[model samples]
Target: ACDVFSIRAQTASPPAAATAAPAQTANAPGAPQHFGRSAGNGPAAATGLWDYFWRGLTENYFNFAGRARRKEYWGFCLFWTIALVVVVGAGLFIDDTMGDPDGSELPVVTVGLCGIFLLATALPWIGLNVRRLHDIGLTGWLFLVVFLPTIGWLIILVFALIPTQARENQWGPVPTGVGI
Candidate 1:
């Protein structure tokens, strides 16, 4: 009887383990999560607002083909912003005729170019940010908080400071390093 009992126990344990194994390897259901993971590598991708702007506009303009990592997207925004300032400054300096005080056609052109650059830098991110929020299952209307001056600024600051949700979310999968 003891031998029979022991054999039965062993057989039960194997079946239990077999049942558990599938659950352990089971994939979770839902959209892929993509938050706070921007350290993979495939290609350098673009490194600024302008770079991503041109690329996204030309390639991903209307193409919501894949998810975008917030860190990389935001990082590009920062880099291009600095680059924009520097490039605009250099352009103005060059337009100044090596340090002339009088304003002229060159200055006008420089100012116009700077305005265009600023617009180009701002436009795409606005759309991208909305799309990002949409991926997170949030409405793009939240972006309007930025228009409220202090309130908007505070709202954006809070959003930026928060950690992105991990795991697959409604935004699909977290973007891989290739800036997909």
Candidate 2:
């Protein structure tokens, strides 16, 4: 009767192993730990948009030998555009204040400001694009395609939109924030 009771009890409920799997998986040594964050916000998450943008301008300004994931590239692009607009706006205001009473259509002050910004950012911009190409497992030399007549910018834009390669390439290991 005891044996029948035990068998019936075991059969009546779910198996012990079945219930223990989730617990084991939660405590498994090899499983990833999120602490309290959701899966997407884990430690392997990407850096902030501002961090990526500022770092590209300062820390990685001259760095061309490594890879740059998609987020880093786009972050730089977005902030660069914003900064450019701000600079131009400030220049326009200055020009307007300084009395352009001659009714000149040329925005000399704005043009000068834009030129300065362009010169200052040219190297860092190229380096970022180079690293972006490396992340895609392509040669940085391909960035020269931007010099093409009409299709150059379009090609570079296409390259920028391409996703990063999952595996590390000759440039270096997969960039941080990007998971294996």
Candidate 3:
């Protein structure tokens, strides 16, 4: 009878392990006890400008399923802007250094290098934009707004500046700890 009662009780209630708090690591006195490695914690956090840019170019390259934080989008933009300036400056320098005294023709090497750089980065740029749109709770197809001229650029800029959704929508997980 006791065995039968014990078995019945065990089957009726959840196990103690299931109700217990998640295990946490011991930390020094007054130190913060980290639960897990989230986007906001540890050295792997994407908070840094360079980290956002490099991750977008590599880890998230061509990834269109998840949301992107504002920092990630803007960091990539900042990197692209700096790269553009450098590439243009280098091309101009090369042209000036190699061009003939008579400036009648274009600099082939400078044009070629700039063209190659633009071509190489084009897909990643599009992917970043798409993810940026996704961050703001919009579909990636809305990236076509870039083609509508002045207003389109303004719209896309607004979209990029907008904060990411605080929770996951149809898209994948939130990019930061601020959202669910």
Candidate 4:
């Protein structure tokens, strides 16, 4: 008698996982289920967003050859945005406290802080974009679509909203939490 492994075991490439930025967790066949917004049950579901965000900055900073679930992509974006706001706000406060003589002067402090923050997060965001593209079964090169003048970002937004593939792909297996 032949015992059949999971569909993922048959089709997903193990080597492809090496390119993934975040550590992968395997779901037990009869794992407990938690409802609402998470893909995992219990604590796994509760921390999924934060875990996804931190992993994007640390583990996936240079990872561009794998798949990313929508939750992961959005989690990274949400934190990046909050951090940007905080940095800019601090810069503005510092500039105000310093009391610039001329109101016409350029916002050096604001620009500098925001610039550094953007530079630091740029690569991770790019890698995220590429992996996000792969998640939806698109070529990573389509990331160029994000460079298209005014409409580029809009196009990418649509891409980001798309759900993950329901099965294993060339890049890897279905992300944890999603249903097959």
Among all candidates shown, the one with the greatest lDDT = 2
Tell me the tens digit of each residue's lDDT in model 1 across 1-180. Answer: 469888888877566767777553223676233332233334546555456556655555554333454664566567667768887787787777555567444576567778877776565566666656654556667878889967887886566544444545555554443322
Clashing pairs in 3: none
| Model 3 lDDT tens row, 53-87 | 78767776677666777887888889888888898
Residue-wise C-alpha lDDT for candidate 2, range 1-180, written one tens digit per residue: 469888888789777987878545554788654321132333554378888889877878788888888998998999999999999999999888887778887889999999999999999999999999998999999999999999999999999999889875677766776777
Q: What is candidate 4's TM-score against the reference?
A: 0.72
Give the 10-residue window scoring lowest on summed lDDT in candidate 2. 33-42
The regions of model 4 sitting more than 4 angstroms off are: 1-47, 102-104
Candidate 2 global lDDT: 0.83
Clashing pairs in 2: none
Listed per model in order, the count of residue pairs whose N, CA or C atoms clash below 3 Å is 6, 0, 0, 0
The CA lDDT of each predicted structure is 0.59, 0.83, 0.76, 0.81
TM-score of 2: 0.72
Evaluated at residue 46, the lDDT of candidate 3 is: 46
Query: What lDDT score is found at residue 128 in candidate 2?
Result: 93
Count of backbone collisions within predicted model 2 = 0
Cα RMSD, model 1: 12.9
Write one digit per residue (lDDT tens) for candidate 4, span 1-180. 334576657677777757676554546556544322244344543346778778878877888877888988998889888889999999999888887788767778999999999999999999999988888999999989887999999999999999999866777767667777
